[model samples]
Target: MQNSNLNLARKWRSKNFDQIIGQDLVVRILKNSLYLNQFFPVYLFSGQRGCGKTSTARIFATALNCEKLAEFQKNPKTEFPCFQCASCIAMQNSKHPDFIEMDAASHTGVDNVRNIIEFSTLMPVLGKKKIYLIDEAHMLSKAAFNAFLKILEEPPISVIFILATTDVEKIIDTVRSRCFQLIFSALPNDSLVDHLSKICEKENIEFERDGLELIVNESEGSARDAINLMEQVRFSAEKITKSNVQKNLGHPDDEKILMLFAKLSQKVEISNLLGYLSEISFYELSATFIWGQILKLSRVAIYLKYGVIFRTNFDLEKISEIIKIVNVKHLINVMEIFCNYEQVFAKTSNKNILLETLFFKILDHSNKIEVKTSSLIKEPEKKSSETVPWATFLQKVEALNDPLVFSVFKRAKFINAESDKVIISFFKNYEFLLSILNDTRTVWSLILEEIFKTKNLETQIVEKEKVIEQPKADIEVEIHKAEPVLEPLKKNFKSFQNSKVDVSDKDKWKLANYLLESFPGDLIEVKE
Candidate 1:
């Protein structure tokens, strides 16, 4: 009978280098080093979590101290340590005095380093080599790392150090230079699937192929995460099904996500689309989850467009339908819109409304692209337009050789420029420009008219009143009529607000301009 209390990740941890998954290069190098009897004073292991750095370190330590090393070396096919030696048994049971494992996250001070250094000086008590494995070694403080420098530079021959970290760059260069480095990678989906499959069979857990694959996807290449998820799904049902996995994990069904995109690509009405979205439970799926789905769908569509098919469980037919209505550029635009609003999606509590807003925004972006009706065909890419020079209106005003108009107009900030209109903002201090243009509307109109003859652009001026709202003056100020110093603070706050809006508005214009340039004749509108 299987142990009900033990988690699959811990129970199935690799016991030997041969049992390690998806680290062929590392295993090979370590095995060769062992066979050749070449041992380094220190070794650095770096990779994402659950990629078998610590497990390999333990197995290597066992092999280094195994009593039957000569016998095992004679048989090239035999796995490391033979798993029968007294030292190997001691290591397995965590009873080996020579093998020490320290979590650097908990012991990050120089005192910890001093203790470790003192321990390194001691000769092996129960084995040939005294090995120290420090996991998350990047968490060590600067002083602790500096304390490690001397010992790392000239460590005892009988002692070996194995430092493992998810982030290798955080380690000091001096300490890193003293060690031999090995880089581990997250296991591939196929590797993780195969590993999980064996574990399921060994444990007598039943699962559907698709359901297991879903677990692998959720694990994001972490073997431990995949096994833990598999164990969770096992507890949910006797035989894992796609629906069971989705329901238990609260994952929006892939079919539903695919259909949502299909309807979106067709530019269905917002109300109807929102209803479709409600059926999927936007709160459960969440805006961030849906946004991730959109990115994945976009990638699949792009790959399909280029005739490059990948191993994907997403309904290819549904994705194909999306690719037919929306081309690669349209998909990219959708992804870009999601990318820009990702933070908003993550922070907003009203996700239903936020996602609904994105739906409309995506539809609006797609409508600008002229998609081909036929299957497997894309519209020809339009040639890019030359970069438009900024403040062309000011250039036109300057050309008129009117110093007063030029000087006043030069200070005006360009709010926006479109084929139909050009909007500029003037502060209250520049009210004279508005009055001057108002007095001579014909002269002002002629300059813009000549500049945008092709666009037929009309000019609009926005005046900013420097009216600042200050907190009700303090009681003392009101009683004594003391000069309040809050005027500058209020101005600064208002300037910050205006500057923030200006940046957001600037991005909208850039996107609109890109669409106009890409599609040539499309009427790309920018809405507030």
Candidate 2:
């Protein structure tokens, strides 16, 4: 495959207003405003990257300069520049005498802006009007902004200023007010998917409908990103399916996550957890997204517990394991643990530690999980068959309000609770467990108490075994967390009695007032 043909972005860039796939409202407004006796001198186009903000600006400029505007409208050649014309060619080549594009980020100093203003005063050498388009105008410095204020407020009749920026807030209110602002919206999922399908057809690549849908879901509305991912997929193979898409894109193939989740649904055990972890060890799924996938499975188990009747991407074996040990409330508890630990996902270095800590903590807290069981000693035998409440307790300590805690639990193969103990199982202990346990001083005892309390019962954690003590030489260095380290804060002294710095008249007056207010002191007059 040719390298030039590989990048779909370069081939698919919209050259005309009609070629622009999205932004119907924007196109309508721009078309209506153009060719009128009244011209907008200053225009602001703002939106996210790869959403056609720059492309729209270029097309609009071309449409204004198109020679065949009337003739093309009658014959309908195109809704934008007649590319064959001299003006359109110049604009396309960026050599148009009337059009000048500037990157404000690179030249946002006062001197650079002053030169632009000087150039703006010159008359248009060709075309109807001279247009000054500044990209990323938010980067302009305060001095540069102030320098442009005069021209922006009173540009000549033949000059038009087009300012573009991703962050509109950074632009001064005065500059914003002087322009016609247009806000661009993200491309809808349906539109993005449709476009992807078309691109695949054009590229002569085969991909499953589900595979393309995954790309759309993962792209998060950035069409450019979707294309880039597609390029990666194409680069990897001559053909693409949902499975291959998952492998190429490094997505959490719900199947693999489902397998892990299914194992978790089984009774909590080390062997089962390790097996699940080993099954899908490739692609080195980022700790954060891996945690997120587990979070989703936990939610699914809750759905089943509630009899919500939702379908899952996970296979039957995975769901079967979930049915074994998973319950609605337990699922919620698992989610809560992972959710708390997720907050520090960006900062933590060792994802494995965080991941391990999560699993250990879940095991420690999941001692007494509640299920839909009516046969409790308190409840009748009839209620026991409907649902049952179980507890899972372990020997390890846990964090109460950490995201990693919930994530490990979310990915838990199983959580079982004894009357006073909780056990948490994880698919594989990696970054998720280690970081959650070692970092983020999140305490789990409180969470255990809360989870138990929700079931109308009380629970407490006690160390399962007693350790034998032996006399040995201890380390010399001591680190005390509670001790006040500051020298001045070491004591409750009222004042520095031995201080040598002389107080000024103002200081003395303030001190005198404070003493008077605090202790009712009165100054005595000095006799000469």
Candidate lDDT values, in order = 0.79, 0.68
lDDT of 1 by residue, 367-473 (tens): 55344364334577543331133356677778786665677667776555567766666775555456556655666677676665433433454566565554554
Candidate 2: tens digits of C-alpha lDDT, residues 1-528? 353653787677778887676799998788766644356888999987778788888888877767877765565435456688888989877789888889998988999888888888899876777888899999999889888888888899888888888899999988888889998887787888888899889878887877777777677777888888877888897766678778876676776777665554443675556556666673366666677677877776777666565554445345645566566565676787787677676578988568756765555544554455432224543533212322232123223333444544444433355566545444332323434443322455444555543322222233334554434443233556796566654665464334233334644464444345545645664433
Stretches off by above 4 angstroms in model 2 are 1-6, 35-38, 70-78, 264-267, 297-325, 363-528
Q: What TM-score would each prediction reach against the true structure?
A: 0.68, 0.62
- Residue pairs in clash, model 1: none
Q: Which candidate has the top score in TM-score?
A: 1
Task: Report how far off residue 413 is in candidate 1 (Å).
Answer: 31
- For candidate 2, the per-residue lDDT at 160 reads 86
True-structure lDDT of candidate 1: 0.79
Q: Please give the distance, in angstroms, between residue 201's alpha carbon in candidate 2 and its true position after superposition.
A: 1.7
